[model samples]
Target: MTGNTNSIENAGDPPRRDQSEPRRVHITRGLVDVLLELAEENEPSEMNVVLDATPASSFDATFDLDPETPILTHFYLPSAGQSVRKVFGVDLGTPAGRGRARFLTHPQGPFKLTERDDFAAVVLLAVPPWDDDTLGAFDRSGRKLELVVVDAEPPVEEL
Candidate 1:
């Protein structure tokens, strides 16, 4: 006398994963434009922006740009277990007699004068996972942009 135990549980339901877990998120140029619009509206002194490596991956990160120090900070790469380089330079073309000069560049730092009306913007380039063959096959750079507004006030502490 065997009882039937072969019935499937929630067969029609989609698989569920923990929402709190750090998952990969795709950040497209269009999404960046939407974020820019949102940032323009609020103009928060400081804000925290997070980016996921993919949709179902365990790579998550955050970036911050401080206007007070006028420096970019709090860049985390969990997968790498460290923070990335803060400053970078680019060639801006040389003068008639001047040699090739490098312009101070902080791609993930404060926004340029032209990019904002009242708020400064920070641009970050996120490289995709090197181990991801599928992603690497299409795009070697795997660059994504993340923007955060620096906050004016400090966080309150609980005593």
Candidate 2:
């Protein structure tokens, strides 16, 4: 019933980061603000967003990560559910599929990731509509991202 039980493809589950991997993620406060803003814009309906990430060391469109490398979230944009499900249906021939730092906001409650969510996303969320100060980021496996809010976004034009 298992071949590489941890593989995202094996169970169609999101790839998990074990204790050996870097658990901390640094994201810009600006990005969180954007999420809250999007939430307001999409309120009454769940909002989905695609965020751009760069490894503190190395990263790729494939989202394969080095055990020791950390990640940072900078730029993000509003996305549709189907677009994210298909990586925007863009030509994956280039780095256009480069972001794994995607998000979906549920105006519901606390953070809880589910099977229906796009495996590549790490829903960094804040609730109560106006509470941008409170935020949470989690992966599909229920492991939390030790989030650090930074002051600025990266200089990349797009992801």
Over 4 Å off, model 1 = 1-26, 55-109, 112-159
The per-prediction tally of clashing pairs is 9, 0
**How does model 2 score by TM-score?**
0.59
Per-candidate Cα RMSD to the true structure, in Å, reads 19.1, 8.4
| Local distance difference test values of all predictions, in order | 0.27, 0.60
Flag clash pairs in model 1: 24-54, 24-55, 25-52, 25-54, 45-150, 45-151, 46-150, 46-151, 111-121
Task: Write the residue-wise lDDT of candidate 1 on 12-42 in tens digits.
Answer: 5676676444322233333344334433443
Weakest 10 consecutive residues, lDDT, candidate 2? 56-65
